[model samples]
Target: MPQVGSAHGGEPGLLTRVVEKVFRFVRLAEFEILFVLFFLIAFILFKDLMSRPQYNSIFVKKPDLDDRWP
Candidate 1:
């Protein structure tokens, strides 16, 4: 009797091994990954929101005043 799949007997395929390694890495760095992603998404959203015309009104321009005092 011979194996039907994979040259290495019943071992997992290349993609399966790569996926497993990625999953393991993600599991170990889950918190760090989530934290980075959260900040990244927030930054992107903030940048997008600030680019809108409505947010520009939030900053009021100060009028120029004379430097001399009475």
Candidate 2:
């Protein structure tokens, strides 16, 4: 493995070194990047979730398919 934080030329210890590489690539602070990335993925996922319109149980059901036409 190419050691972490090598790109920034810092003599950071293990934790700081990992944080440096992650911040470089992910564009967020070490403490916040995980939440940011998680929300980003969840946003993309829930974007697709928005169109799911639940109807009355006795009413006509819409064509629910895996293919998205939008």
Screening candidate 1 with a backbone cut-off below 3 angstroms (N, C-alpha, C), the clashing residue pairs are none
Worst 10 residues of 2 by lDDT: 51-60
Per-model C-alpha lDDT, please?
0.87, 0.70
List the candidate 2 regions with Cα displacement exceeding 4 Å.
1-28, 52-70
Q: What is the lDDT of candidate 2?
A: 0.70
- For model 1, residues 1-70, the per-residue Cα lDDT tens digits are 9977659888888899999999999999999999999999999999998888778657755455875653
Candidate 2 lDDT over residue span 2-69, tens digit each:
67757556566788779878769767465577878899999998766664555343355567688688
TM-score of every candidate = 0.70, 0.32
TM-score of 1: 0.70
Note the residue pairs that clash in candidate 2: none
Alpha carbon lDDT of residue 69, candidate 2?
84
Question: Which ranges of candidate 1 are over 4 A from the true structure?
Answer: 62-70
Please tell me which predicted candidate would have the highest TM-score against the true structure: 1
Least well predicted 10-residue stretch by lDDT in candidate 1: 61-70
Each candidate: RMSD to true structure? 3.6, 12.6
